[model samples]
Target chain A: MTERISFRSAQKKALDIARTRLLVGGALLAAAFLVIGVRLVDVTLFSENGPSRQANARNIAVEKKMDRADIVDRNGILLATGLKTASLYGDPSIIIDPKVAARALVGVLPELSEADVLQKLSSKGEFVWLKRHITPRQKYEVNRLGIPGFEFDEEERRVYPLGRLAVHAIGFTGDDNKGLAGIENSFNTALSERSERVTLSIDVRVQQILRRELAAQIKKFKALGGSGVILDVHTGEVLSLVSLPDFDPHTIKQASRSEKLKEEFKNQQFNRTTLGVYELGSVFKIFNHAIALETGVANMASNYDARKPIRSHGFTISDFHAENRWLTVPEIFMHSSNIGSAKMALDIGVAAQRKFLTDLGLMRRSSIELSEQQQAIFPAPWTELSAMTIAYGHGIAVTPLHAAAAVAAVINGGILYPTTLIRRDELPANGKRVISAQTSADMRKLLRLVVENGTGRNAEAPGYLVGGKTGTAEKPTAGGYKRKALISSFIGAFPMNAPRYVVMAQLDEPKGIKESYGYATGGWTAAPVVSQVISQAAPLLGIAPVDETAPNARRASAIKVATPRARGQGIATN
Target chain B: MKRPATLIIFGLAVFAGAMLFGVAFEVSNLEDRLTGLNKEITRDRDAIHVLRAEWSYLNQPERLDGLSQRHLELRPLEGRQFSDIAALPMRPNRVPTPTTDPVSAETAPAIAALVNAEPGGLPSAETPIATALTAKPKLKPAAPRRPARNVRLASQRISPEATTSTAASDKAALDAALRAIFGNTASNREGASR
Candidate 1:
């Protein structure tokens, strides 16, 4: 009986131990499941950022991307684009036979030297470049050779499809696709970072016309070189900018390889329209006449004695075609009388002349986007002699672009808008007002008078009513001006009543042709080019031609001038 | 009862596992399609990039200028060629008595019918149209109607013999008229301007 009781107690003790273990295991499992459930809820509904969001963020990285943005003209014609190309590279360590591989490569790419390729392939280095960019057909031909070490590194090459058309504007890229010059250098960061295209203010058709006409004139006159710019007078957008003797952007790569091409490349890279500064002679009279009218020192009826040349400080200021008599303001501008302009400048004083030119944005470096720009060379002390010479555009020198911008300000109601190469949706409201609207109108009348009966008669586009000034500056040398080498330039605006465009053409050292009556002056050379350009570009720009025979058309460009001969004799030459 | 409940739970677990595997496979298949589509898009984009570059090369102004000079009779427009719609002279009230030229002889009956079929039978002297036409004594016979009629007839019928001969004649006449009006075949334009 005692044994049976002991056995029952042992069975109960064993059951009790098993039950305690079961409870401990159940508690542990419940805690683990609760932790997992809480974590799931936090991740799905409560966590601010999660792995799922990170995965989605990664998906966005797979969208289309460009190495560099395209450069287009105002009409969306592609000026510069990035084309996909494969660069040939090799793993020299893996190349079984360097000579055989190099020979095969030279067979496909005739441009590559076999010895050079072999040397590169035989190097101990793990990687070497066989070539930078290869044609697709060459890539295929190389692949067919089944060379072990050969591999293609994908890259994009910058190409200008229009060749040398606008090389000075669009610029070119280097081997690594970095912009080297022109707008490429100016807007490098923006181009590489953004996928959107850069739209320039240039009209390719207008550019073509300007280039063709400038080139033809340069060839005909046997000039050294030429540059031209056509700007929207009101908006300050450059429609066309052409610098002659320009090189194709594609040749830049080859230029580095050959010494002859290097010399040619350096010569062609000089952008004359923006970089080279010259004492643009009579063109400055546009500013002088404008200044005289605006300061109220001279009017259309105002007269100065131009009977004899003014000899001041060992310098004689005389007219190119002297009308040796008392001259009114209109007569001085029309005949380009340097003596009359000097006397007028003397009356206005030096301070006013400097202030007026500064106000016209001609005293400083241009605010254009090009990195190739020059500061205007002006007299530092600005003496009386300087004022007189500057009045006829001698003491001060500026670029053709500066002259263009200043002329635009003069004809565009005396407001100077900052010039730009990028297209603008609206005229900038921050334009500085240099002269009164009345003064601007008076200047237009003077410009028209010059084109009508004076030296700029060659600038007439007939019904288009072109009005401009002729500037024939003797190229300045180290000690004095060279008489034979002249910068013959014409700065003109068409439809004089409401001028829309400012066209400036300049020929460097143009020799006289028989057709020009042995005259290489602005009136003989540059004026005809301007007239042709205006006539051809007017219809393209949607400018309607007015019948000059119509009474209203006659009234639009007409200015009344008092006869200088009737005014009287000389007021005594200084 | 416990046995049957355990059996039901086991069966439900098997169904849920199968559903999980099926959904995972479907997701994988969709991901594969997405990858393929992305690849195709990239290839097509590259092709478009190449084609755009080629197009720009082909459309160079210098090349186009050369091509036009060789293949086309068109020339740059002159200022005198443009005039306001109001400046154009009014249409002539009376058509020129059709010439008995071979092409015109074939269409003379059609033109007579067209002129006679006018709603106002005689076109009186006092009518505004007649007055407008009479204002310009140098107005030429505007023969625009005949070519338009020929185009309409050429499209509507398919008879091989008679229609083919007339169509050929009509085409030649149309070409001459078009060359005179719009095509800058200089000779034709010079005659018309004179």
Candidate 2:
């Protein structure tokens, strides 16, 4: 029995050896499978960038975000820019002492609420915000705190240092680092994503001068609002734009202010030269005469019956200080006779008139680059009454930018181009044609007649050959049009013989000034202001004085058709 | 056996050669990478220099003044001792061109040529046109009836028609004399300011 038991023990030992070998082989096989799986993951996630070789690869450190490109002027003036800023926050989960961190934080940022800070610090959140848009100084102070849980998250913030200057064109950004208003808002994608700098045509100095002059006028007149615009007609570039009762964009405390921000935008929503719509009084008459001449319905000596007020639908169309006689086209423009302009528009025909305005970019929203833009308010049905009122600068509203573009067409040899704020290479110099060259010349002569003798007399700037029109429209009140409250504006293009630039200045509810002899009319106010600005800026603009007296102006003037009575008188005299 | 041992030594030498080849390949790659980094640095430095120079050029205040001078006939600033804004006389109603018609502008009296080389009547289109080409009537800022050739529209608001609308002829006479002293415009206002 002993011999048999010993033999069984030996067999058990042999079986135990086989069991150990199987276990070791299985373990090795499992290790090989695990290695194959990891290698597969490595190939899928990263070839050279995988953890297997990541330590050897280059550019493996922190990535530097190439943030938003800056918007600068042609001369590299910073109109808009983004700066890298650090946002301070805390990991509440790691913060050991809530009271200690709160006390330390409040010391650096007095604006922060200590109770709120402590509450945030004591929260169970993995992350909590401490301060946003922290300046370098505040960052330095926070760094000095050296609190264990405190940290910084890199961020970018847009700041306008000039504040309110060119605010409409430059625009403002929203909280999430996006543009919400102006050029900033409109071109947000280009600015934030693109690496190339976006250059604008604004001359900061010119902008300052325009804003300064407009502001002084606003203050002097004690008006509710004011706007001014200057254009480089040849290039279709806006030199300066102004709208007042401005705001400091650096610090805005209220969200309500942000929505009403357009109102306080100085020239924000009021791109009077490009966006606001108003029946700009007599300024529209320039278009009327041009339309008549271009359509061959009127000549330089054509007569219009404006001897008395034409009372139609309670809109008495008459000239102030009435001539009470049949007036020539030049004389009519000089006198700013609505009755005469209505006649010119009628002769041009409604279809041709609408075509001309549309061609001139007056019947639609302007194509400028700014976000704040509006369509011109025109008669939907476009009735005969609409045509008449539109001819005399009534029954329509348009932005200043639109008017500027149209004015460019009037004096710029009837070439019209949409305004541009962005600086670009190779602009289309010859804009779309809105009228015949001969008609444009006739319009200029008519404009000169107005500045020389009519209501725009104040607009004459010696050698500048300045020609313009003045408009004073009573503001529409809640009940009816306010007889006293008015919107007075002057639009002028200098060196009218071959126009170079268009300048328009407007005063909203301008009070009668002692210097202006207590007259709030456009001639007494807006016209003179624009005339002065033009006269001062002309030589700077490099506009050489042409010898207007050089016998060319008479030749350029259309052949004056004589009246039958005048011809008969000449014959009789002969 | 000794031959087999010698064969083993040669195999060891081949293994060592392969290792050296791998090391050389790594060193060459590192050299290429270093060169690329150096090139990047150089390019960044050049960009910085160009941007700096452009910034300096743009910041030059003379650029604005130059542009302004090109666009406007801005007078050089003078010590108010010589000219005061408050002391200006009330402008005339219509300051049209005193010489409105080119016929009148051309009717200017012929003057003796200043330089022997210049043919004096009206400058030809080829010649550089200057207000100096026309003889100045006065050499002062405040003057009356300056020479028609040199007289531009005065910063004076009075249009030519308004020149006759003055309340007093005596003030006009005094203005005429002051213009005579500064009116020449031959002297560079920019130089004087500088």
Candidate 3:
């Protein structure tokens, strides 16, 4: 009986142990399944709402790829672009036979010398450059040579497709594809980011026309050089800006090594349109007349005595083409009379003249997209003689760009807009009003009178109603003005009934030609260029030509001159 | 019943896991294909960019001007050649006035008659267009009258049955008309060579 009782207790203890083991194992398995199920749900459902870490990493890799943006003209014509090219390189250490490799390379690239290639291939370096920016045909030929050590590196090179055309404006880049000049330098950051393409306000067609015409005149007159700027008066967009002796941007790297060629290249790179400042001659008369009319210091009927050369503080002021008599305001501007202009400036006073120039954006560095710009040279003390000479465009020197902009302000209904190379969606709202509308109209009429019967008669386009001023200033020397060297320039606006554009052409140190009747004056040299440009570019710009014989056009352009008391006075000579 | 139910749940879970894995594999394959296509697109874009730059370089205005002067007969348009729609002569009232020489016989006589009828000139009466056309008497006498006869003769000689004699004359007339339209081809070629 005792043994039976012991066996029963043992069995009960064993059964208890088994139940505890099973219960523990079952709980562990259930906990493991719960953890995995929660994890799977989290991964499949919540994870879809956000990007995985790997995807984020791939996106970063994509963003790191760098490319430069393209530059195009206003008409969507490609001006400058980056092209992919393969550069040839070699692993000299891997080359089996340096002489054979060099021979093969020289065969493919005739420009590369055999000695240079052999030296490079035999160098004790791991790698060396055979050539940079090899053409695809050459690259293929080199690859087909079955040379094991040779390799190609994919690279980008900036190319200006228009060659020498507008080279100064659409600048070139260095070997590393970094912009070193022009629009390239100014907008370097935007280009490297490859965010969007850059579109300039330049019309390639207009640029071609302006360059061809200006180059022809520069050759005809035998001038040292020339520069031209065409500005939209309403918007201040530089339609065409040209400087002569421009170099081709594409092959600038391979140019001849002669010192003279290098110096010529440097000179060609100097942008005269915005960088060079000159006394701009009588183009300032347009500003003077506008200021006189705007300030109410002179009117259509107001008269000044130009009967004799005015001597102010030992400085003699006269006109190149003098109408030596008491001259009305219209006659003063029409004849570009220096004595009349000085007397008128004296009436307007020095402070007012300075203020007028300052307001016209001539006293400061004009704002443009180009990094190459110089401030205007003006008299520091604002003396009486300074005011007198400045009246007829001396004592104050400005860039062709500045002169063009100021002329635009005078004829573009008196608002002064900052010049720009980039196209604008809307006209800038910050333009300051410099003159009254009525004064602008009266000034237009006087300008038209000058083009019609005065010194600017050569500037008239037969049916375009062209109105302008001619300026011929002797270049200043150390002691006095040079009698032979002259800067002849013409500033003109077309369809004077309502002005839309301002064109300025300047010739530097033009010599007299036989056809010019031995006179290298603006009327003979620069005025005809303006007429040709307007005649050709008008139809291109969609400006219709007006009928000059029509009664309305005749009446509209007629100038009323009030005769003065000193009409029969003696002639003034410089 | 409890054991069978547990076994059935396990089987369903295995089936679901297999489906999930299959879908994931398919998605990964498509993603790979998309990546390859993207790379191809990038390469094509780069190629197109290069081609466009080359095209622009080849089509530069200076180069095109030289090439056209060599191969084509064309001249730069002049401002005087442009006229307003109002300046165009009114189409004759009657369409049946067809004549052998359309340009010279019909139009020139009508223009001359109009100029004569009104002492002040055409009905537009002192339009600049009339003044410009009249001012260039040298151009009017030669340009308007000669091209008309040449064009008529060239068109009438298009028949295939023409003998060699007539064919030669036809060819000469056609050549003259082409020269007049384009410019002096011989002179252009010479200028290009120089």
Candidate 4:
């Protein structure tokens, strides 16, 4: 009986131990499951910091940058842009049958010589460029050949949409897309770093008009070359700048290979508007008269004896069409009397004339956004003769661009703003006031009278209220002036009531034509060009024509003559 | 009962785990699709950019001008063809009168024939409209020309002396017509600003 009780007790104790151990195992398994559930929730809902996600965001940010920016005109016309092109390259070491590959490439690109391609393909190099910037069509043609060793490298090529139309302004890029000239050269850094389009102030329509008119006149005159400029008088923005014999930037590099073509290419690449300096003849009288009136040296009523040629320092100063008579200030300007201008300059004296010309920005290189700017050729020793000659635009040589800017300042309320090819969103704050308001107004009236009754009569576009001056200077040779080789130019502004643009057209060495009655003067050669350009461009620019009979038109164009006797009599009447 | 309860909880946990895994796989598949679509979009954008550049190049002004000169009968707009609406003369006062005579209306057909026959040439005033109408019915059949002739006459009556108008007045008329076509709100605003 004692043995049975002990065995039962031992069995109960063993059962109790087994129950405790089972409970502990169940608790441990429950805790493990709960921990796994918590971990899943944390991973799905709470974890935001992952190294892979950050890497993805960083990669996207790095891919958005472009290699170059586009260049567009003021009206959002695309002038210069970059396009993705495929360039063919060959791995010489891996190329199977280099002759077959060269022959295939030559078939796709006819411009590529077989000898050159074969040499490149057979060279002992890992890689060599066969052609750079091939057209998509060429790339497709090449790909269709199934040349095993040849590969295409994607690149960007700068293209000018208008070709040679604004080639000098938009310029061209080198093999590696580096700007070589014009606004491209000037704003290379800005263009290379940004994808935003650079807008210039060039109106392509106006550029076409200017180029067409200048080219027609240049061809007609059989001249060496010509340059023209149309500037916004108020903003100093160059609307149109045309230098004749301009080259196509696309083919310039290829054309530069031939000796004769190379010479022509060099000539065509010369930006004459800002680079070539010439003695711009009676056009200087506009400034001369303006200076006299501004300095109180001469007034509208001031009379000068222009009855004979003024001989000073063994140099005879005579008008092209000599008016041997005493002339009023208005008459002197109307007839373009060189003697009277010299007399006026003598009265103003050399010091004042130099100061005025310097203030007008004629003594230094014009501040335009161009790399090819030449300083005006002025006489070194300021002599009385030099002042007299400069008065008639003889001793001073200035570029067409400089003349355009200076004239703009004179007519645009006498504020000289730096000329720019880029579009200006706001008026510049640093425009230098060079002359008084009264002088600018008087100058406007005088310019109108010259276009109306004087030598620039042909420059009038019926309702345009054209106002201008004629400049016919003889080109200087080794010893003296070449009378036949004349640099005839016309500087004009329109809607004289409120001038907005100043246009200057020059013909180099224009021969006398029969239609012009054997006269190759500014009025005959260049004035008509200005008239055509103004007539065509005014409508494009949305300038309204004014009725000549209107009181406002009369009031704006009317010049007050202090002397009543000089009013009815013609300036040329002796 | 406790053993069955444990089995049910374990089964539920396994099912939840399976659903979570399926959702994660689906999300991963959508993300991969999004990346592929983004790449395609970027490639398409690049192609569009290239196409726009080519379009500009092909639409160069000189090339268009050449093409027009060779294939189209159009010219650059002239300044003389433009004028301000204010410069136009006042319209003449008139009262409408319907003519019952078909002969008078027949003159319109002749004029229309003359206009079509000579595209750019103006009808000569020396050839009387009445005489020309009586002489030229053979150019086209006169059956279907009555209503067209009446409509032409009504348009012509608005400007009877249009052909004889001076260049300046013609320019002014064109200007007024353009202003009527394109509203004068811009000019009115300009005037207001001034």
Candidate 5:
């Protein structure tokens, strides 16, 4: 009985030890599980910078960035955009038959030479680029060839959808996607760094209209080239700027590199609207008239003796169609009298004229968003002869853009706003008042008179109430002026009661056409172009035609020129 | 009791581990799906970029102008074709009687032909109405024509000629004829048709 009791005690002691060890193991396991659960929750729910979130953030950063931003017109029409394309590359090592692969690629991409591609595919290097910027269709065609060694590297290409339409404005990019000219060059950093589109103030519709009309005129007149600009007068926004003989951006690199096309390529790349400064003849009279009235040196009734040519400093200033009689202020402008304008300029003097021209932004390079702008060539000496010739648009060379912007200021209630190719949500608040409202009003009347009964009659777009001045400059040679090679141009504003837009059309060396009565003058060549542009563009611009026959309309635009008293009949009658 | 508790705690630990493993597997599957979706989105975005460029190229003004010249009879809008709503004479309550009316016979058949010619009915209906209202005609159309044509005539109300009586009578007859055809729904049709 004693031996049995001792055996039971030993068994009990072993059970107690095993039970205690089991409880300890369970508690340790629970603690480990709790720690793991807490760690999981902390990593997932509580952690501020989780691995998954970090990966997502990195992916978002990659997705948001682009090589270049798109360029769009004011109407959000795509002008220039970046297209991600695939470039075909060959693995020379893996290519089974280089000849067959190259032949296949040549068939798909005809522009690629078979021999060159064969050489590349058969080369020692492991990789070779066959073509860059392959279209999706081309990539698909290449894939269908079942070439084992061919692959594509993703790349971004700058594409101008409108081709050559706005090339000078939108510019072109190089193979490295770097801008080389025009707006692309000017806003390179902005375009490269930002993903947002750049919206320019160009209207593609109006640009087409201007381009079509200008090209038609250029073809008809047998002119060397042409440039045209249409600017919103009130806001100083360029609606359309066109320089003809513009080249397609795609061919620019090839054209530039070609030895035979070097001169032609440079000529085509020239942005004439802002860069070519010419002695834009009678168009300067618009400024001359405005300056005369603003400085209180002349008025609508003021007269200048235009009977004889004014000879100064071995130069004789005479009108093309000379009115050999003493003329009234309005008569001189109506006839585009050079002698009268020269005399008026002498009266206004040099300092006032320079300051006025500077204020009108004509003396300096235009502040337009272009790198092609040239400073106006004004005489540094400020001689009497210079003032006289500059008055009639001689001795001073300014770009067509300068003349357009100045005219915009003259008609847009005398406020000179810096011309811009960028759209603004509001009218710029920084416009400087250059003339009184009354003087601007009177200038509008005088301008209308020119279109109504004077030299710019061809510029009239019946009910649009077009008003303008015509300029015809003889291209100056090394020795003297080349009378036959004329730069014919017209600067005009429409809806003259409240001018909304300023249109300038210029033709380089336009020959006389049969329809223009064989007169290769501004009124004959460029004025009709402006008339057609206004008639077509006015409707597109949402400008309504007024009843020009209304007494109020007729009377408002009318400027009475005092009759010349029958050539000194006042004394004769007395 | 201690033995059962120990087994239960070990069982709970295994259950939690199994659940954690299943959730981790599911989370990895979800992450893979997210990556796939992101790749698909990127591919779609690239395609859209290409399509947008092509769309812009096809809609170039010069190309559209050429296409329109070839395929459509419409010309660019002219300045004379626009006028203010205020410039339009007041709408006459009555339709004018057929007097000096050669245009309705011509315009009615022409309009009906246009309506039949067009696949979409409403645009054709509005185009003729706009042309008739804006184009000032010296001769008035018959009573069967729309009343808006009469409004164009009534704008000549300022004229001092004695022909006002005939015009006034014609307007009244036309209004009655229109009311007879459209009934009270004439107003509703007029508004809805435009």
Candidate 6:
């Protein structure tokens, strides 16, 4: 095929060859792209392969979604966490021989019976969990069995490593990883939906202190139960809140329902400080003085005719330690005078008294970190007599926390807060206002007087200007107030000139101790407990123990009283 | 004929070079993914380490005991041990102590060669050692309750393990030494529970 070539013809032939080469290259590129398109379609539509997530296409399920956050203390201590645990789950329907698989599984899991395993494996269901919350070791043992149908389902298990220490605040979760109680249940959304830890106000060290003290008191007094709490005056932050009869949140089985947990709650079972509400006794006198002082019904020099009890509705209101003489405002508080308090409330008028209580957050249920809370019981119909009775902490039943909040507002510059459970930043949450600042000052004076000369005298702690009122409310049963059943409690603040902290200690049905001079009233038993608590806590809380001889301390000790005629008229009317 | 051969070799060499470069790029991309995975593991490990440290901090028994002792003068209640606050009579009013600060009067004991002879001569004002000891109790009323007990539990006998200054030094040293020898355990994670 060699043809003799002329110069012009040879050049034209070369150009034609170049054009053919370009056509070939374009055809090859189109064919290659077509092949790739066909393959992509085969994998997307026709393939029987596996899950859609391309990275894990060989696996049965999509990349197992694992999204959970942790709960830690402000100090970075892990309180609650969702840890990824290897759980033993299986494809039941895919098992080739149920009996063989069961035998193999039983060998690995000693707890499982061969018969039981076979029944579960042979079941018509496509999915079954062999064991939940399996350990890494167990997963390894089971995997070695080489059961084709068995597989692992990535699962999240909630763990509270601190157990019962901070259970009420950290809370526990259910199998489906839902919040059940405490912060776990209350702010489940923030804990689960968000990735940040929920830091509670509870200090682990302070909690330990409160728990240990309560436990000791319960044992010493032969009390069936006990509870304790510590609150910051300015912020209303709860440093420590303990309820005896606690349940370990780690193992759900140990903490059955409240019915079971109640039995376990014995000495340390129920959290009496916040959750349990009682008809607290003389402690209510603080509320009455606050109301009186706020309404301008009395001054520090005013006197109340506390010589006789005020009898009404066949019920007598009198001091536990009767002071059968005229008592100045400070004297009435120092003596925990129920009779004097009645007169003071009467002077303030029934409407004003009710308004004061409403302002103190007593008329509602507590809004704390834990969901478990009870509303304080108050008289259904607000009456003049009810006003007088409630003033002395009768005709109304509130939680120890209710007593704590009212006392806190009375001394913390009259700003009332919904006692908190979670630890917050230096700046406190905005709180609701319930009383005036001047009244708070007067209440502080009255509280200090009580510690120095009243029923709370036993509660005085050297150096820490201690002040508070003691409550020993007799439990009202079918046959009037029972002599045996008593709600014994004390609420106190230190450095009363400018208060810092509030500590409330209560012993449920505390029995008389020999050293207590055979008296189980709030003054003898619970007040002394506070003294010990103050002595130990003041230094750690960073309060400088000032000498009582100081003029500032002496000047602040005055307590205002609602004069005598107000008391005489109140008594005669009742 | 020789020129045509040269042209064919040139074409072959260029095609081979391009293929080799493409393969190398693919290998390097795969390696990059692996390195990214290792970095993620390290981040997770660091997070775990921090959480573990926090857990230990919260559970430290000495801290809890100190707080408890201060608030209630209450000891940790074992099942067998329980004492009431009311069991003790109004803590008998303490008799006034006559002393200056006790620390200077009874100088600290030499432990671990921490103390040395004072360079300055002694007395400015004469204060009795007994008075100084008395003053000491008032300064740290809570310390006497169980200072010894805390010392025992903290380090099984506190050696002043590592405070602010030492802790930083120790951590840095350990981190540097480990990083030098191990290349990054996260990068070559060849074991479980490692």
Best by DockQ: 5
Clashing pairs in 3: none
Worst 10 residues of 2 chain A by lDDT: A565-574
Residue A80 in candidate 5, Cα distance off native in Å: 1.0
Complex DockQ, candidate 3: 0.18
Candidate 3: TM of chain A? 0.89
Mark the 10 consecutive residues where model 3 chain B has the least summed lDDT.
B130-139
Interface RMSD list for the candidates: 9.5, 9.6, 6.0, 10.1, 9.7, 12.9
**Candidate 6 residue-wise lDDT, A282-306, digit = tens:** 7888888887777788877788788
Give the Å error, residue B135, model 6: 18
The digit string of per-residue lDDT tens for model 2 on A1-574 reads 7788888888889899989999999999999999998988788765754644543344332223346667776567776666667898899988889999899899889999999999999889789988888987999989898888899987777766556677777867776778877678778888888756788888776676667667777788887777888888777888877776555555544435565654455443455545566668888888887888888898887777765677777677777656666667777777788888887887887799899888888877677887677788887888777888888887788776787778888777778876888875786755888887777877777777677767988877765677788888777657557877878888988777667788888888999989988888788778877877776666556664433343433333233433223332222221
Candidate 2 error regions (>4 Å) = A1-65, A253-271, A546-574, B1-194
The candidates, ranked best first by TM-score, are 1, 5, 4, 3, 6, 2
Lowest lDDT sum, 10 consecutive residues, model 5 chain A, at A565-574
Native A-B interface contacts kept, per candidate: 0.33, 0.00, 0.34, 0.29, 0.57, 0.05
Which pairs in model 1 have colliding backbones?
A: none
State residue A45's C-alpha deviation in candidate 4, in Å.
Answer: 5.3
The 10-residue segment of model 3 chain A with minimum total lDDT is A57-66
Query: Model 5, range A40-123, lDDT digits (tens) per residue?
Result: 999978997788677888479438567899999999989998888899899999999999988888998999999999999889
Q: What is the TM-score of chain A alone in each candidate?
A: 0.92, 0.82, 0.89, 0.89, 0.90, 0.83
Task: Give the candidate number with the greatest lDDT.
Answer: 5
Instruction: Give the range of the ten consecutive residues with the poorest summed lDDT in model 6 chain B.
Output: B83-92
When candidate 2 is compared with the true two-chain complex, its DockQ is 0.04
Backbone clashes, candidate 4 = 0
TM for every model, in the order presented, reads 0.83, 0.70, 0.78, 0.80, 0.81, 0.71
Would you list the C-alpha lDDT of every candidate in the order shown?
0.81, 0.69, 0.79, 0.80, 0.82, 0.69
Model 3 docking grade: incorrect
